[model samples]
Target: MPNTRWTIVTGASSGIGAEIARQFSAIGHNLVLVARRREKMEALAAELTAADRGFVEIVELDLAEPDAPAKLHAQVTQMGLGVHTLVNNAGFGLRGEFVDLGLEEQVTMIELNVTALTRLSRLFLPDLIKRGQGGILNVSSLAAFQAGPHMAVYHATKAYVLSLSEALHEEAKPFGVTVTALCPGATESEFGARAGMEGSRLFSRARMDAARVAKIGVEAYRAGHAVSTPGTRNKLVKALGRVLPRSVMRKAAGEMVG
Candidate 1:
């Protein structure tokens, strides 16, 4: 490393994480791709390398594990790379009634989606604040706008992410650090299959492309937007919880999960 500022993107093996990495790299930002899948990262790194846009480093990690955020921060510090941005995108979702799901798995979802994201943001934010630039692009979801049925835990985690990111943005913006909460609707990714939502009505139709979602997120972060809802009608996400009756929104969310 030749004294470079880097962007750390977690869960960077596939889908939005991978696409976001590409987006940043295209704009000439070196990246540290963190995830459990080394081979996947290697392939992505190869692709980015061939583009000759920016350097790509891979850190294989399970962010759900305790101490992962600390370890990753330490490793990045040891390598002498100053982090410019931290993309807290390492997360997953499961679709099912909360009570019917395995307890440990649900907890793990919380660990990765909420705890890990918070830890990484805490560890890396001071650096951005000190530099008076850079940003944190958190991959929240449109589901954060309302309570989701069948995917209760996942929705709750995303809600937490959205709320936390917005607060951080308000605090960091004065210092010139942007914290963007990207609230994209259903996108073409492994998330649907992994969460068992692929067969659901919400995903039965054509979904937004992962590349498009990533592009929108990167644009939002660069523009210092606090929250972004990609591929939505009017994109007035704040209106969802207010315009619709709480009961009606809840029922509609449940019906979509069918």
Candidate 2:
């Protein structure tokens, strides 16, 4: 039987997003997986189906495109899938000085990380409020809590996500909807290589597993927590940012990225 409600996970082809989909499916939530790679999503769908996890739907899309959000919503509606959860996980980061990075790439990053996330949240929020019980899980980063010198735009985007999610959490309380920001530190994933941060000190240090991080994030969403940082070390790092001076934090961040 088809699940009555669906959890939509963007960037579902790999990394944390992929793990989140698996965990959600394991918990018997029907899924709508969206990503730019159709073949990858199709493979995931097949695996989930073979396991009889739940009904899995794949929507291959590049959400960075201006019309993608509306088109995605339309596809879900057309498929008669009522969205019970939205995971805005489709974003990437670039490790470079802001001025040295390609202008087009930075703009596209903003489009994906900030614009797409905000648009999807707004597009789905009305329905979630009407249902009065759904949730939004935004995958931010530990970078959200501090300023990053080399990856300035990426850090800013995550900060936006953290801020937006917290405010939405408060606003949605009366409606019984939960909004959570999952802030994970450097994890074992493709992110480092893709972002050109593979050789950075941060990635060289200890990292958490994507599956573990995803499990923690999913559990936090289920518990209606406003923000969740997976590893104990990550939590401590985030806490330390509170007492550290802005100059010190910036210097530390710059050194890590270097």
User: Which structure among the candidates has the greatest lDDT?
Assistant: 2
**Model 2, residue 113: displacement in angstroms?**
0.4
- If scored against the real structure, what TM-score would every candidate get? 0.96, 0.98
Candidate 2 structure quality by residue, lDDT tens digits, 1-258: 556878999999999999999999999899999999999999999999999887999898999999999999988988877899999999999999999999999999999999999999999999999999888999999999999999999999999999999999999979999999999999998899989999999999999999999999999999999999999989998888999898998899989997
Candidate 1: global Cα-lDDT? 0.91
List all candidate RMSDs to the true structure: 1.6, 0.8
Candidate 2 lDDT at 256 equals 95
Q: TM-score: which candidate is best?
A: 2
Runs of candidate 1 with Cα error greater than 4 angstroms are 1-3, 234-238
lDDT of each: 0.91, 0.94
Task: Pull out the clashing pairs in model 1.
Answer: none
